[model samples]
Each structure stands twice: as C-alpha cells, then as structure tokens.
Target: MKFRILLLFAVAFLLLTTTRLRVHAQSGKSAARPNIIFIFSDDHAYQAIGAYGNKFAKTPNIDRIAKEGALLNNNLVTNSICGPSRATLLTGKYSHTNGYKRNDRTRFDTNQTLFPETLRQSGYQTAWIGKMHLNSLPKGFDYWNILPGQGNYYNPDFISQPNDTTRYKGYVSDIITKFSTDWLDKRDNSKPFFLIVGHKATHREWLPDLQDLGAYDNVNFPLPSTFYDDYKGREAAKQQDMTIEKTMRLKQDLKVDADYDKDWTYNRFDPEQKKVFKAYYDKISKEPAEKKLTGKALTEWKYQRYLKDYLSTANSLDRNIGKLLDYLDKSGLAKNTVVIYASDQGFYMGEHGWFDKRFIYEESLKTPFVIRYPGVIKPGSKVDDLVLNIDWAPTVLNIAGVKIPSDIQGKSFFPLLNGTKATAKVPWRKEAYYHYYEFPEPHHVFPHFGIRTDRYKLAYFYNGADSWELYDLKTDPTEIANIYGSKGSEAITADLKVKLKQLMNQYQDKEALQILAGAKK
Candidate 1:
C-alpha cells in the first residue's frame, strides 16, 4: 500500500511540471508577436493628406506616420466604392468573390472567413471600434462597437455586442477615438491585440464639427484645372451625375438655407442643434445671396464653401489621430505596436469636376497607406511598388507569424517591408485590375472595368454603353486625352487588352470575362 501511494504522488508531480512548462512556452510565443492597430477613414482622398503632398490641408499627425515609418506611394483599391472596398480589405478578395459587389443595401456575408478571425484563432484579442458599415454584425471580433450604416456626424449611435445601440454625444471622430482608447484600457494585456479604429468623417454631406465650423473660413481653395472638363473624349464622363456644378445643391450639400427648399438633412437635427447650425450658416448664406454670383463666379463660390467644410472635417480626423498616437506613446505600446493608417477608398475633392467616388480615375483610385512598425520597418521608407487593398489581410497575417490561407487572392508584400527574400522567387505583379459596377443611381457613374500599369491605363465601359478608353499615362498623366483607337496606338492597345484578359482569367471574374468577350465581338 505504501509503495502504491508513493508512485501516485510521483505521477501527479510530473503532470503539474509539464503543464506549467507548456503554459510558459505559450506565453513567450504570444509576447513575441507584435500588436496591430489599423486606422481607417471614409472618403479620405490621398490628395487631401499633407503627407501625400496636399498643400491645401494640414495633417501633421497623419504626416507623422510617414515620417516614422513607410509610405506606400502606389497603394490602390480593387474597387472605388465604400462597402466593396471595406469587404476587399477584410477578405483579401474582390467584391465578386466576397459577394458584396455593390453598396445597394447588400449585407456582408459574415459566414466566410476573415483575416481577423484568423488572428483571433491564433490567440490574439480582436476589437473593432467605430464605423464598420457592413450592414451586418461583425464576425471574429471578441469586442465590437460599430455605427449603424453611415452613422451620424454628431451624436452617433454605436452598436455594441449582443446587438444593442447606445447614442453617444460628441463629434463622430472624437467619439470614435474615445471608444478606441477605452477598449485598450479594458483589454487583456496577457495576449497581443489587433484593433481597428474606423472613422466616418469627411463623407458626403460634409458636416464639420461645431467647434470646427469656421476653421477654414479664411482660406479660399483654387479650382481644379479640370473643373471645366468638356467631356469631349470620354463618353462615360459626360453621362455621370456627380459633377460639382450640377449635382451639388446649395441647401443640401453646402448648408446654405436661403429658402429652405425642403432639405431633409437639416430636418434630422433637433431644435437646439438646428439653432446652433443656423447661427453659423445663416451668417454666411447672406453673402452669396448678396453677390448674386452666376456662371464662373457661382461655381468658384461653391468650390470655396465645399473645400472649407471638407477640410474642416478632415481637421477633426487628424486631431483625433493625434490623440490615439499619444495614448500609444504614454502606455509604452509604441515600441511593439504596428500602426497603420488607410481609407476605405479615395474620394474626389473637386477633381475632374466631380464630387463623389466610383470612377477608376486617379484621384479616387489611389488611397493613402502609411505604416509604422517600430523595429521591423525602417523609418522614412517609401515603397513605390503597386499594392492593393486586398493585400492588407495577407500582409497583416504574415506580420503576426500566422500562416496565410492558400485560398486568399492577395499575395503578401511583407517582403517589401522587411527586406527579406520570399521563400518562393515569384515575380511581383506589375499591373493592377479595377472594376466599378454601381451605376444609374445616386452618382450615376457607369459600370466599367479596366487595367492600370505603371505607364498606361485601358478601360472598357459596358452595361448598355460599349466603349473603350485608353491613356498613355507617361505623356498624358492627367488623362485628358484618350488614345485608344488613335493612330500609332495599335501595339500598346493590343498589349493592354492581352494583359487585361490574363488578369480577368486569373481572378476568375466570369462577369468581366463575358463583358470582355462581348466587347471583342
């Protein structure tokens, strides 16, 4: 009996020792993985960011990211629309593959796997704060406080876990920043975290914060050179309804309440809110009425008002970013956390006489992407290689030492950051494919798909209107001239079509393939 008792005691001691060792090994592995913070904003054009050379705006906090880390000069989006771009960033796949192609009130199919889910499974705590306009509750996140639909600019309602919404009072940008920091305070420090701070500032119907109402009042923005584009060569450009002159309204967009033309936007505000808004806008409204501005003068006046409000909204966004960066520094998380700033897609700030995004134009196609990885990436580095929104997932997974799924369409560009050779010496993609499907409603941008190389761009506008447009980017950087069927352009056009077809096949875009076939016939 004594011998049996001694043997049982020895076995129990061995089991305890093994368990403790396993726990210690797991803790060490988690500590080695770097934390990730992805900051996303809506309708923020790369041209508006000071880091990207916007002389009209001040973005010191955003510029700091570029100064501290790497800037992706050629970061482009697969789609230029809102929800589709967000879907692509999460799934690392195009809109067709993810089944959220258009923003016509379609719900994001959350059943499919997302990169955040992969991170959560790998023992990382995940949380998403602020706008995630997916029309569905976010999956794979342990904690989420998101906005419903586009969310209000003031006193937005944040939808929390277990499906409950609570209204918070403040500017949307400031409220989002506060929730993000609060989440950080309550998070489990034992495990590494991946947090997404999404902001809804600078979206259409640009409403500046009350404090920022008169921020840019002193500045008068110059008109874009293409503000008077005749649409002489481009058929699709002529048919769209997103023009700054015609589509933008004085009461609805510019907040000029001259006659009150039944504007529903202002009706949404409460009595107190309306009083404050009227006090500020009513004073400015009298000037335009007194000037009796028309034609060039009227357009120029509208441009200044639009720019002032847009820049004021952007000012709040930049200030909030500073707050988050300060928290990281004070909390000692700056050394190990990888901070990333990006947008769902770029917007048009009076480029080509347009006010909305959905075209495959340069202003809307390119987004600002800045990253700061303290130890891994060298400071002030600039990557000129073409990168897409779809690459975000694979890159983040690779950074966390997580194995990227084989089915993800995007290839990780982590090698570009760390200066390491890929295990497989595959060539990087030299061109990017773009497709926009939303049309005939809202902005009325035509459905088109195209390919963009370093020096050229070719597009096919189909969906009732069959046309081809090509640009020699080196000679026509502004894309003012269409050289598709022009003389001496046969070789380049044929080459671009071949490359476009190859990409369509690679991505398995059956709709695009059918369209290409029809266009060829």
Candidate 2:
C-alpha cells in the first residue's frame, strides 16, 4: 500500500510539471510578437526634418528613428490630401477604391476590412489615440480617443468609444502623449499592442505651444529659389490658391493684430496660457503696421513668419516623440517594439511659394517616413524605393504576423526592412502613380494624374485646364522647365503614359481610367 501511494504522488507531480512547461512555452511564443507604435503627424513636410537634410530644423526625436532603423527617402503618397490619404492608409487601397477620394463630406466605409481588425483577430490589442480626420466613428479599434475633425492645438476635445468626448487641458501634442502613455499602461499585458499616435501639429494656422511661441524667432529663413515662380508651362501651378503671399492671412494665420477675445483659435486658451500667448504675439503684431511693408518685401516677410510659426509648432511634436520613446525604454518594451514616424501628407515649407499640400510636385508628394524596429532592421538603413501610403496597412499587418487580405492593394515592404534575400531582392515597381481629385475648392489645384519615374515626371491636367506637363527630373531637379512635347521628349512621354494607364488598370481605379479614356478622346 505504501509503494502504491508513492507511485500516485509521482504521477501527479509529472502531470503538473508538463502543464507548467506547456503554459510557459505558449507565453514565450506570445511575447515574441513585436508591439507596433505608429506616430502619425499631420502635414509634416519632409524638408522640415533634420534627418532629411534640413540644417535649420531641430527634429532630433524624429531623427532618432532614422538613426536606429531605416529612413525611406522616396516614401510617396497615393493621393496627397488629408482625409483621402488616411483612408488609403486604413484600407491599403488607393483613394478611389477606398471611397474617400476628397476631404469634403464622404464617410469612411467602416464596414470594410481595416488592417486593425486583422491585427485584433490575431490577438493584438489595437488602438488609435489622436487626430483621425475620417468623419466617422472608429470601427476596428479596441479603444480610440480621437480628436473631433481637425482638432485644435490648445485644450482640445477627444472622442472615445461609445461616442464619449472629454476635454483635455494642455497643449494638443502634450495631451495626446499623456493619453497614449496612459492607454499603454492600462492595456492587457498578455496580448501584443498596436497604437497610432495621431498628431495635429504643424497643420494649417500653425499655433505653437506657449513655451515654443518664440522658439524660431531668432532664425531667419531664406526664400525658396522658385518663390517667384512664373508658372510658365504648368497651368495648374499658375491657378493654385495656396501661395504664401496671397492665401496666408496675417491677422488670422500669422497672428499679427489678433483679437484675443474674439478669435476662435485663442478663446480656448486658459488664463495662464492666454497671458503667455498674448505677451508674445502682441509684441510681434506691431511689425506690419510700423514697416508699411509692400511688394516683395511684404511677401518675404510673410514667408519668414510662416516658417517661424510652422517650425515652432513642430517643436512640441518632436518633444512628445521623445517622451514616448522614453516611456518604451523605461517600461522594458523597447527591445520588442516597432516605432514608426510619418505624416498624413507632406506640406510646403516656402517651396514653390506655397504653404499647403495637394500637388504631385516633389514637396507635396513625398512625405517623411522613418521606422525603428530593433533586432530586425539594420540600424542607419536608408531605402530609396518608391513606397506609397497604401503600403502602410500591409506593412503593419505583416509586422503583427497577420495574413494580409487579398483585397489589399499594397505589397508589404517588411522584407525590405529585414533585408531578407528571398523577398527583398524581388523586383520592385520602377514608376510611381499619383492622382489628385479635389478640385477648385480650398486650394483650387486642378485635378491631375501622372507617373513619376526616377528621372522623369509626366502629368496630364484636366477639368477646365487641359494640359500635359513633363519634367526631365535629372536636369531640372527643381522642376523649373516643363519639357512636354519638347523635341527630345516624345519617346519618354509616350512610355510614361502607357505605364500610367497600366498602373491605373492594375490598381482597378475605374474612375481614373474613365477620366483617362475621356482625356484621350
């Protein structure tokens, strides 16, 4: 009887040990999945970053991502508009297919398969915290605290799940950081996490935080060489209403002679915030009236003010990025976490005498994209491949070990990050396709579609401005001269047109195809 009792005890111990080992192995497997944090900013120009060769701009925190991992030089956008760009990101499709081509009154089709839902199904906790301009409630996120449509820079309101909105008191950048970290702290530890820290900084009417008001006051920016563009060949350029001279308002945009009590932008500021803001701007407001500036002098002054305000507003954005990086390090999540920094679309920083985005031109087309995926991507790597905003969703899904749906138009550049021989060496697309649909409203940039190769750009503008513009990018890097129908450019123009049509057909852009068909007739 004693021997039998001892045998039973031994068997019970063996069973318990096996169960513990199985559970431990499962936990290890779960922990191996990398956590993803996408730090998305609004209208952040690539030229305004330190990593992208901006000597004057102080973007150390964003530069850190480039230093640690990869910086994509030619990361272009599919449709260079605010809402449409974001919709393309969520769906991994172009603007037309995603059904959110323009920034006006269209709602994002939440019923469609968003990449976040795929991540969640694969056991990752997904969330989006900050500005999401898609005029609808977030559907796939487990938790989302989004700004209500072009959120204010000071004391903004965030919309949560079940349509709950709470006012947060602080600079918009700072508030977004706090809420993001708070969510990170409270999330379930067992599952891997994916968070989108959407920022409204560096957008239109650039308003800096109180501490950052006069940050760029000492720095004098030089005018862009093409500041006084003749718009000789490009009819679209001549028709645009986005130039800094004419579009940017002094009292409203630059805050010269601003009404503290009446202006909606300033009314949200609390007493202490208001006092600091008023003290700074009131002193600067007297410049225009005192100088009685006019002609080129007035235009140049506006350019200086625009750069100062825009860069100042970006200060808080970079600082908050540092905060998030610090948090990841402190929490021991740094090793397995992937941090990505990018913008909705690139903005114009006195490039071509413009202030806003929405063109297939270099400044507005190519945005900043940096990623830090430790242990996988080699440090200080630079990818000059033609990756688009549509690729973002598939890349994120790939990082989470989730299967990308067949409907997603983007191919994952994950292989590019890892530098794997098998997939990385696969032939990538040589030419990038671009289309802009928004017409004659905010910027009045005419609707256009085109293809950009390494050495050339060919575009066809329509809707009352029927014209074809081609630039030999190798010679005209600044795109000063359009060589369309030029003596030597017939073959290249014909080639680009054929390739553009092929891309449109491949992407299943029916509307664009119809438009192209009509243009040909």
For each candidate in the order shown, give its overall lDDT on alpha carbons. Answer: 0.87, 0.89
Q: Estimate, for each residue in 1-521, the C-alpha lDDT of model 1 and write its tens digit.
A: 99999999999999998887665343222246899999999999999999899887979999999899899988999899889998887899988899988887888988887999999999999999998888889999999999999898877888998999898876789999999999999999999999999999878788887778888898878788888888878998889998878898887788887333366455445567667877999988887769988887888888888889898989999999999999999999998899999999888888788887888778888999999888677789888888999899999998888999876899888777755534435367899999889878887788999999898999999876578999987988778798889989999899999999999999899999998998942
lDDT of candidate 2 over 1-521, digit per residue (tens):
99999999999999998887665343222237899999999999999999999988879999999999999999999889889988988999988788998999888899888998889989999999999999998878899999999999999999998899899899999999999999999999999999999999888889999888889889988888889888998888999999888999988899988887998877888999888988898889888778999888999999999999999999999999999999999999999999999999988888788889988889989999999988778899999888999899998887777899999999888767777634336677788989998998998999998899888898888998888889988889778798988898888888888999999999988877888888842
Best by lDDT: 2
- Model 1 accuracy (lDDT, Cα): 0.87
lDDT score at residue 180, model 2, on the 0-100 scale = 97
User: Judged by TM-score, which candidate is best?
Assistant: 2
Every model's TM-score: 0.92, 0.93
Per-candidate RMSD, Å: 5.8, 4.9
TM-score of 1: 0.92
Clashes of each: 0, 0
lDDT of 1 at 331: 99
